[model samples]
Target chain A: MVSALGIQLGVVGAYLLVALAVGLLAYRLTSRDAEDYYLAGRSIGTVVLLFTTFATLLSAFTFFGGPDLAYRAGPEWILVMGVMDGVLFALLWYVVGYKQWLVGKAHGYVTLGEMLGDRFGSKRLRALVAGISLFWLFPYVMLQQMGAGEAIVGLTNGIVPYWAGAAGITVFMIAYVVIAGLRGVAWTDTLQGLFMLGVVWLAVGWVATAAGGPSALSNALATNKPEFLALGGGLYSPQFIISTAITIAFGVAMFPQINQRFFVAKSGAVLKRSFALWPVLVVLLFVPAFILGTWAAGLGISVPEGANVLPVLLNEYTPVWFAALVVAGAMAAMMSSSDSMLLSGSSYFTRDLYRPFVDASLSDAREAWIARIGVALFATLTFVASLFRPGTLIEVGDTAFGGFAQMALPVIIALYWARTTRSGMFAGIVGGQLFYLAHVFVPAFEIAGITVLGGTYLTWDFALWGMVLSALLTLGVSSLTAAAPEENQSRFSEGLRAD
Target chain B: MTRTSIDYLWIVTFAILVTFAVPWFLWGDSRVFAGLPLWLWWHIGWMVLAAVVFHLFTRRAWDRGIVEGGR
Candidate 1:
C-alpha cells in the first residue's frame, strides 16, 4: 500500500507533468513572430480569452487569500472581492478594455507603454509606465511563489521545504514561459482554470456533505460564531468595503497581464461575450472557497499559526488524494498567474524599456531572445524575494493593488480625454505613486480621519485618496499644459468615431 | 460615437447596482434564509442581476459603441 505522503506527492507530480506537457505542446503551434509569441497572434476565441483572463487574474489571492480572509474576518470578503469586483471589473472590461482593443488593433500596439508613449510622442513616459508596472509587478509575482511554497509545505506536512516548493514553481514557470509564450500560457491557463474550478467545487461538495449539508453549517455558525453571519463586526465597515471594492476593481484593470489581454481577442464579439460571462465565472469560483472558509469557522477547525486555513481544513476533512488534487489546483492558480506576469513583463521590458533606451535598432529575433532572458532573470529575482517572505499574502496583494490603482486614472484619461498631455500623464503617474507610497510607508496617512461626534470616527482608505489625487493632477496638469498634437490625439479617437 | 439611450441606462443601472451591492441596509439584521444570511442572499441576487444586465447590454448595445464604431 502507498503511503499518504507518497500519494500526495504522486498527485502533485502528475499535475505538474501534465502542465509542462500542455505548455510544450503549445510551442509547436506558436510561430517565431514577436506578436504571435506575446499575444497569441491576436486570435484567441471567447472561451480561451475568458479562461485565460480568469486564470491570470485570480491567482493565489483568490485560491488562498480569499479563504483565509473569510475564515479570519467573515463573509463580508465576498462583498469586497466577489459581488462588487465581479460587476465592476466586467464594466471596466467593457469601458477600458473595449477601447484598448480598438486602439491596439488599429496601431498594432503590444504594450500599454507603447500605446501611451506613441499617443504623446514621449519615450520617457513609456519607460516610466513600464518601470512602475514592473515595480508593482514584483510583489505580485513573488506573491504566487510565496503561495506555492506555503501550499506545498501544508499539503506535504513539511516533507517539502518552503524554499524547495517556491524554487520548483519558479523554475517550472520560467521554462514554461520561455518555451510557450502567450499561446502556451493561454492553453495551459484554460486547462488549469478548468482544473481549479472542478477541484474547488468538488472539495466544497465533499466537505459540505460530510458536515451534514449547508443548513447544518449555517446552524453551526449561528451557534458558534454568530458575528460572521452579520455586518458591522468592526472588520467590514462601510468605508472598508467600498474602498476595497473600488481599489481592487481599478487595480485589476491596470495589471500588465490583464491589460495585455485586451489586445488578444480575435474579435469585438469575443470580447463582448467574455466580459459578459466574467461575473458569472467569478461567482462560480469565489462562492465555494468563501463558503467553505466560513463553514470551517463554525466547524471548529483549528489552523496552525502560519499555515493557510483552506489547505488545513481540506487535509482534516477530505480524503488524501482529493486534498492533493486541491493543492495542485492551488498550484495551478499560482503557476498560471506567474507565467502570464512573466510573459507580459517581458513585453514591457523589450518594447518599452530596452528598445527605446538601450537599443532602438534591435531585430525582432533578438528582441524575442532578450524578452525570454528578461523573463528568466525577473522570475529568478522574484523567487529570491519570495524566499524572504516579507508579508502575508493579503498584505502583499493589497499593496500591489494600491500601487496599480494609481495608474488607472492616467490610463483612462489618455485613452478617452483628447487633451491629455505628457506632462499631465507624468504628474499623474508620479504624483499618485508618491502619495500612495507615503500613505503605505507612513502609518498616519493610511487612514485619514476627521473628528466627528466628538471622536475621530470618519476615515477612508489610502487608495481612495490616491485615486482622487491622481485624477486631480491628471486633469489639472493637462489643463495647464499644451495638448498632444491633433493628429496624434486623433489616432486614439478616430476609430471610435468611424461609424 | 453617438450616445445611445442604452448606454445611459447601463450607466444608471450600474450605479444603482453598485450602491446596493454592499448590504448597508441589512446592517445589524441577522436574518437567515436558504442556509445563508439575508445580506449574503442580497449579494447573490445582486450578482445575478448584474450578470443579467451585462447579458442585456452585450446583446442590445455592445456593438453600437464598440464593434460598429471601431469598424
Candidate 2:
C-alpha cells in the first residue's frame, strides 16, 4: 500500500503546478510595463478585484490560524472574525477605498504612500508611511511563511522539515510574483480563492457528517464544552474581542496590499459591489470553519498541543485525497496572500523609498527592475525570519495588525482633514507608534494616579489606547499648526469630492 | 442625503452596534440557538443591519459629492 504521506504530497504537488501554470499564463498576457505589472493596468473588474483582496486578506491566518484559534479557544472567535470583520472591513472599504480609487485614478497613484505624501506635500511623510507600513507588514508576511512551514510538517507527519516547507513556498511565491505581477496575482488569486472556498466547504461537510452531523456536533459541544459555545469562552474576553475587531478593521484598511487594491478597481461601482458582497463571503467561509473546529472535540481527534489542528484534523478524519486537497488549499491561501504582499512591498520600496531618496529621475523600466529586486529581497528576509520561528502565527499577526491600526488615524485625517499639517500627521504616526511600543516593551509604571507604558484599560488591549492617543496627538497638533497652503487644500478637496 | 449626514449615521450606528449597542446587552446572556450562541446571532444580526445601512449609503450617497462634480 502506498504511504498516505505520498498521496498527500502528490495531490499538493499537482495543485501547486496548476498555480504555476496560471502564473505563466498571466506572464504571457501581461504587458512589460510598471502600470501593467503593478496595478494590472488599473483595469481589474468586480469579481477578480474582490476575490484577490479577499484571498490575500484571508491568508494562511484564515486557513490555519482561524481553525487553531477556534479549536483551542471556542466559537466566540468566529464572531470576532465572521460577524465583525464582515461588516467592519466592508464599511472601511467603502469609506476609504472609494476615495482612494478616485484620487489614484486621477493622479495615476499606485501606492498608499503616494496618496498620503502628495496630500500632505511632504516627501518625508511618504517615506515615514512606507517605513511604518514595512515594519508592520514584515511580520504578517512571516506569519504566512511560518503557517506554510507548520502545515507542511503536520501534513507530512514530519516527513519534511520546517525549513524545507518555508523555503519551498518562498521560492514558489517569488516565481509567481516575478512572473505575473498584479494581473497574475489577481487571476491566480481568483482561481485559488474559489478552489480554497470549495475545498474548505467540502472538508467541513465531510467532517461534520462523519462526526454525526451538525446537530450532533452542537449537542456534543453543549454537553461537554459549554464554554466553547458561549462568550468569554476559552481564550476570549469581552475586551479582547472588542479590541481585536477594532484593530483588525483599521489594520486591514492600512495594509499596503489591500490599500493598493483600491487603485486597481475598474470603477466605483465595481468597488461598491465588492465591498457589498464581502461580508457574505466572510460569513460563508468562517461559519463552517469555526463549526468544524468546534466539532473536532466531538470527533475526539487528537493533535499535538499547539500544533496546527486543521491539517491533523483532516489527515485523521478524511480520505487521503481530500486531506491533500485541503492542505493544498491552505498552501494556496499562503501563496495568494504572500504574492500580493511581496508585490506591494516592491511598490513601496521602488516608488516610495527608491524613487524619492535614491534616484528621482530613474526610468519607469528601471523602477520596475528595482521593484522586482525588492520583492526577492523582502521575501528572503521573511523566509529567514520564519526559520527562527519567532512566535505563534496569531501573536505575530496581532502585533502587525496593532501597528497598522495605530496608523489609521493619521491616514484618515490626512485624507479628509485639509487642516491636517504634515507635522501633525507625522507626529500622530510616530507618537502613536512610540506609545504603543512603550506599552508593549516598557514595564508598566503607575504613580500618583498615572499609568505609564501600560498595556490595557480595564480589560481592553493597548490598541484602543494607541488609537485614542494617536487621534488626540493628530487633532491637537493640527489645531496648533498652519494648515497646508490654500491651493493645496483646494486641490485636496477637488480630488476628494465625488465625481 | 447629505454626505456628513450619511457618514455620521454610519458612524453612530456602527458605534452603537459594535462597541456598546448590541454586544453589551448580549454578552451577559449565555443562551444557545441553532448551533450558535445568542450573542453570536446578535452580532450576525448587526452584520445584516450593517449590510442594509451600507447598501443605502452606497446607493444614495457614496459618490454624491465627487463622481459627477470632480472628475
Candidate 3:
C-alpha cells in the first residue's frame, strides 16, 4: 500500500507550489517603485482587499488554536472570536482605519511608524513605535511558524520533523515576499482566504454530520459533559471573556500588518465595504469550527492535551485525502498571515528604522532591496525562536495581542486628540508596556485556582490595567504639557473633516 | 443622511451591549438555547445586531475624498 502520510504530504506540497506560482504571477503586475512594492501601488480592489484582510486576520491561531480551545474549554470560547471580535473589530476598522487611510493617502505613508512620527514630529517616536511593534510581533510570527511545524508533525504523524516544517515555511514566505512584495502577498492571501474559508467549513461540516447531527451532538454533551454547554463553563470566567474581547478588539485595531492594509486599499468605499462584511464572514467560518469542536467531545475523540485538535479530528473522521486537504488549508491560513506579517515587519525596519535613521537619502530601489533583506532576517529570527517552542500558538498570540492593545490608547490619542503632545504619546507607550510586561514576565499567584497577578489583588487581566493606565497617563501628561503646534492640530482636524 | 455625531450612537450602543450591558447581565445565565448556552446565543444575536448597526453607521456621510484616487 502507498504510504498515506506520503500522499498527504504530497497534496500539501502541491498546494504550496500553487501558492508560489500565484506570487510570481503577481510580480508581473508589480511596479519597481518602493511604494508599489510595499503598498501594492495603492490599487487593491474590494473583493481582494476584503479577503486578504480576512485571511491575514484569521491566522493559524484561528484555524488550529481556536478549535483546540473550544475542544478543551467549551463553547464559551466561541463568544471570544465568533461574536464579539466579528463585530467589535469591524467597527474599530471604521473608527481607526478610515482616519489612517485619509492621513496616509495625503502624506504618502507606508508604515504606521511613519504616520505617527510625522504627526508627532519626532523621529525617535517613530523608531520607538516600530521597535515596540517588532518586539511584540516576533512572538506572534513565531506562533505562526510554530503552528505550521506542529500542524505538519500532526498531519504526517511525525514523518516530518518540526524543525523542517518551520524552516520550509520560513523559506517559502521569504521567497513569496521577495517575489511580489505586498501585491503578491495580497493575491495569495485572497486565494488562501477563500481556501481556508471553504475547506474548514466543508471538512468540519462533514465531520460534525458524521458524528451525528447537532441535536445528537448536543445530547451527548448534555449527558456526559453538560458543563461544556453551560455558562461559567470551562476555563473562561465572565471577566476573562469580557477582558479578552476588549483586548482583542484593541489589538486588531493596532496590528502593524493590519494597520498597513489601510495604505493598500484602492479607495475609502472599498475599505468600508470590507468592514461591513467582516462580521458575516466571521460568523460563517467560526460557527462551524465551534460546532465541530463541541461535537468532538460528544464523539469521544481523544486529543492529546495542548496538541492541535484539528489533525486529530480529521484523522479519525475523514479520509486520508480529505485530511490532507484540511491540513493544506490550515497551512494556507498560516502562510497568508505569516507573509503579511513578514512584509509589514520588513517595511517597519526599512521605512521606519533604516531610511529614517540609517540613511535618510537612500534611493527607492535600494530601500526595496533593504526591505526584502529585512523580510529574510525577520523570518529567520522568528524561525529560530519557534524551535524553542516557548508557548502554545494561542498563548503566544495572546501575549502579543495584549502589547498591541496597550498601544491602541496612544494611537487613538495621537490621531483624534489634538492636545496630545509627543511627550504624552511617548510616556503613554512606555508606561503601558512597563505595566503589561511586568505582569507578563513575573509569575502570578494561583490562589484557589484563580490567577492573581503578583501586585494586583483582583484577578483582572493585565490588558485592562495596561490600557487604563496608558490612557490616563496620556490624558494627564497632555493636560500638563503645551499642546502640539496649532498648525499640526489644524492639519489633523482638516483631515478628519475631509470628504 | 448627512453624517452627524449621532451616527455614532448605534456603535456606542453596540460597544456597551457587547462589552458591558449583555455580558454582565446575560452571559453567566446557564439556560441552553439552540444547541449552545443562552449567553453564547446572546453574543451571536449581538453580532447580527452589530452588523445592522455598522451598516447604518457606514451609511452616514464619510469623507469621500479618499475614494477618488489612483486605480
Candidate 4:
C-alpha cells in the first residue's frame, strides 16, 4: 500500500484538504439552528434544487451499477432498471412529489417518519420510520465507502488500499456535510451534478467511438450474448410488465432524498420546472452509463461481478486525464449521496429523535452542533460496517431503498383516498415491512390446495412483489376499519395540489 | 362524466398511447424511430408527458387566490 499508485501522498492530501475545507464551511453555516442546518432555510431556487435532486439520487452505483448489470446479467437488467428509474422520476414529477413537498412545508416536517407520524397521530410511527432509515442507510453509506476505495484503486492501478480510500472518502464526506449542512450539500451537489454530466458524456462517446459506434457495439454484443439485446434476455428474465413498471415508477418519487428535494424547492412552480427538465437529465446521465456498459461487453472486457463498472471501464479505455476525471466523478458521486444522507440522517436524529424525546429544551444552535457530531458518528459507523461487511454495500443500499418504497403505497393512498385510515398506514407500513422481509428472507408455503411462491421456501429479493402483498394487507385492513380522525385526514390535502 | 373523471381518463389514455400504442407502431420490429434510438423515444414520452401536465396546470389552475406558505 505504501508504494501504491504511488502518486505523491500530496495528491491524496489535497483531496482530504478540499473535503475539510468543504466541511468547515458547512459546519460554520449550520452551527446556528436546526432549520438552517436541516433544510437550508428553504432558500434553494430552481437551479440548485434541480442539481441537488439530480446528484442526491445518482451515486457511484447508479453510474457504475448500470454497466455492471449490463456486463454481468446481460442487457435486459440494465434496460429494465434504467427504464424503471426514468419512469419513477417521471411519476414523481407528476403527483407524488407535489403532495410530499406541500404537506412537508405546511407542517415543518423533515423526516418522512415525521410527516407520516404527524399525519397519522402516532409518535411510535416516527421512531419506527427513523429506525428503518438507520437500518438501510448504514449500508448505503458503506457503499459510498466501497465506491471510494474502488475509484482510488482504479485510478492508481491498485497503488492505494481499500481502507485508505474508505477513510479518505469518509473524512471528506463528514467534513463536507458538517461544513455546509444542507447549503453545502446543495451547492456541491449542483457542481458535482454538472461536472459528472460532462464526464459521463465523454466516457460513453469515447467508448462507442473506439468500438466503432453504437451499432457496431450492438453487433458485437449480439454475437457474444444475444439476450443482451432482448427486453428479457435468456434467464435474465426482465420484468417489463405494465403493472411492474407502474409499481417501480410510482415508488421513485417517494425516496426520502427525493422527497426532501421537494421540501427545499423555492416553490411548486420551481419544482415543476425542474421536473420538466428531469427526463433530459435522466437520458443525459444514466443512459450513458448503460451505453458504456454495453460498449464494454462488446469490447470483450470481462467486468467483475458487482464491481464499480464506469471507473473500471473508463480506466481500461480512456487516457489518464479522462480517467482521472472519471475518478473524480466517482468521488463526486460518493460525496453527493453521503452529504445528503449526512444532513438527512442528522435531521432524523435531531428533529425526530432528540427534540421529540430527550432534549426539547436544547437551543436550536446547540441542536445544530449536535447534528454535526451526529453526522460524524453516522459516518464512522457506516465506515465500520463497510470495513466489516466489505462486499454487500451496493445491494444492501438497494435493499434499503425498499424501506422507502415499502412505505409508498400507504403514504400515497392515505393522502388521496378518504377511506384511508391511520390503521391503513400503520398496517401498510408494518405489514409491508414484514412481508418485504419475509419475502426476502423467508420461504414458500404449500398448505391445502394452495402453494405460495415465497411462502413455502426462502427465496430471492421480491422487492416489487413484496409491495403487492403489503398493499393488499393495508387496503383490506383499512376497508374493514373505521377512517382516521377527520382532522388528521384533511390536514395534508388542504394546502396541497393534485395537479 | 364529471370534470375530474374526464381528467383521469385523459391521463389513462395518454399513458396507454405512449406506453404501448406508440411503441408498438414505431419500434415494433426493433427499428429505430426515424433514426432516433429506442431510449430516445422513452425520453420523448417522458418529456411530452411532462410538458402536457405542466401546461394543463398553468392553463387551468384557477386558483382564485393562492396562499403564501412556509417550510
Tens digit per residue, CA lDDT, model 4, A1-499: 3443343344445544664565456556645533453554555678877887788656755665556666666544434443455444555555566666677777876667788788777777787777766666676777778777766665665666767878888877776665555445666666667777887788877877766777777777667755555444353332333333444454445555666666666677776677556655766676676767666776677544334566567767776556666666557666866778777777777777888789779897898799888889888988887776444434555666665678777777776675777777778888878876765566667778655645222323466766776687778888998865532766676765522
- TM for every model, in the order presented, reads 0.93, 0.92, 0.91, 0.84
- Taking the candidates in order, what DockQ does each have? 0.55, 0.40, 0.35, 0.20
Q: Model 4: runs farther than 4 Å from truth?
A: A1-40, A235-251, A304-306, A388-394, A442-461, A483-487, A495-499, B17-71
Could you tell me the lDDT of residue A195 within candidate 1?
80
Model 2: which docking level applies?
A: acceptable
Across all candidates, the chain A TM-score values are 0.93, 0.94, 0.93, 0.86
Measured by TM-score, how close is model 3 to the native structure? 0.91
For residues A1-499, what per-residue lDDT tens digits would candidate 3 score against the true structure? 2588778888889888787887677666554533454544577779877887888656877777777778778777777875446866776786678878877777777788888888778889899999999899988888888888887777766677888888888888777777656546776777788877788788866876777766677788888677887676457876677788788778877788888887777787797788768777887778777667777776677865335677777878888888888887777667767887877887788878888789999997788788788778888999999999988777888889999999998888777787888878888999999989988898887889876666333666878888999999998887898855522554455543343
Ranking by lDDT: 1, 2, 3, 4
Give stretches of model 1 more than 4 Å off.
A29-40, A442-458, A484-487, A497-499, B1-7, B63-71
User: Of the pair 1 and 3, which is ahead by TM-score?
Assistant: 1
Candidate 3 chain A minimal-lDDT segment of 10 residues: A490-499
Better of 3 and 4 by TM-score: 3
Q: Which structure among the candidates has the greatest DockQ? A: 1
A274-388: candidate 2 lDDT, tens digit per residue: 8667766877777777666767765566766435778878887788888878888778667877888877877888889988999989897787777788878888999999888
Q: What C-alpha lDDT, on a 0 to 100 scale, does residue A170 get in candidate 4? A: 87
Q: Model-by-model lDDT, in order?
A: 0.81, 0.76, 0.75, 0.63
Would you give me the overall lDDT of model 1? 0.81
lDDT, candidate 3, residue B64? 29
